[model samples]
Target: MQNREQLWLELPPMSPEAPRRLLVFLHGAGSSPEAFAPVALAWQLKFPGAQAAILQGPEAHPGGAAHDWFDTRAVAADRAERAALAAARLAQRVAVLQQSTGVDAERTVLVGFSQGATVALEMVRNRPGLAAIVVAYAGRLARPIRSGERLDATVHLLHGEFDSLVPVVHAHQALRALHASGTEATLDIVADSGHVIDQQLIILGTTRVMQTVFRGRRRAAGDGRTLH
Candidate 1:
């Protein structure tokens, strides 16, 4: 087992002893925990009672100084297998995080971007109960869910409308698949957005986290479906 403690930038809660939720963020490919520091800081500031942990990828990027969850280029056959291995490791890390922070699965929110999002989805599928909500941006499902598989989390997929890299269609596909499998999932298509995260998307994600943590507001009145 890997020493997962050395793999994160842990941000403690602002209000000590007040029940805190855990926010675990996984960065995109070729990025480090440092690269995501600003986002983590913003999230902490927005929700001071929430504990944040920005994690680094397990493997070094072949191109240079950054890191990757799994190989993106070449080895088409083993891509899914490799991604699954990475997700399993992340699951272990999440378990450690929950134990250390004293936060339960329902109060934990797992977040990921791009390749990280792929791994987050896989983590939920392979090892459930890490979180009740998953915020995946610019990513897709790692593999097809087998028949009778169950996903207990509420997944929120945010994708840029003009994303050429992964394409918005992937988000749609994930939403459909998750719904078909009886998973609570929603998709938010950002207009005029590209492959990057913007302020609007950040606010949206933060709001969702608040709603989940507080439980004051329901998912609208009439329909159970989220409109966004």
Candidate 2:
């Protein structure tokens, strides 16, 4: 049971009329919410009508400096257990954040990198009815969620062609599992890129996905559908 006291950040919208879309960014292992500050700033600027929240991981690392969403112990040995714990804990934190910020689950999008990507995937799997979209960069789905579970949200997997840390194969494996489970997913390959998300690619890919989600929401809203 991880403590929830240290797991949240609320980045308010620039305007009251800003779109209800909430983008949450999850950082990789050994990184804090500040790691994604630049990307969040860019998103806030580009989508001035949206609010972005970057959540810190729960597991604190050595030096009491950085955090991880889950204990990395036996990640390779017992990934299912690790992922399940992380998913449950993260879902709880997300629920609290939504209540505090007044963000609807159906209007929320999750974006993560590296280990953070794994956490996002698990969160989506645990609460498939929520999350409008999931954007994973240089990460793959945890095996627990890949085992025949159906994911309701659209997934965008962005991977480098030569990512030595996580490997391109991991992305392919996740895609295969997603397809087999009938999940809606789209995979984008960044040519000549590496483990780190390039600024240009992040802006391009994230903006495109956000636009798609907003468009769909608008269309739904026009149809007199309450997106809750």
Candidate 2 TM-score over all chains jointly: 0.87
Candidate 1 lDDT over residue span 1-228, tens digit each: 236434678888988755578989999999989998887777777777789999889788897989899988868788889899999988988898899888888778888999999999999998878788899989998787788987988888999999998899999989999999999777888899998878888887777766664552354434564422
Candidate 1 TM-score, C-alpha based: 0.89
What does candidate 2's lDDT look like per residue over 171-194, in tens digits?
998888888889988788888988
Query: Clash number for every model?
Result: 0, 0
lDDT of 2: 0.78
- The weakest ten consecutive residues by lDDT in model 1 span 219-228
In model 2, which residue pairs have backbone atoms overlapping below 3 Å? none
Best model number under lDDT = 1
Q: What is the lDDT of residue 39 in candidate 1?
A: 78
Predict model 1's lDDT versus the native: 0.84
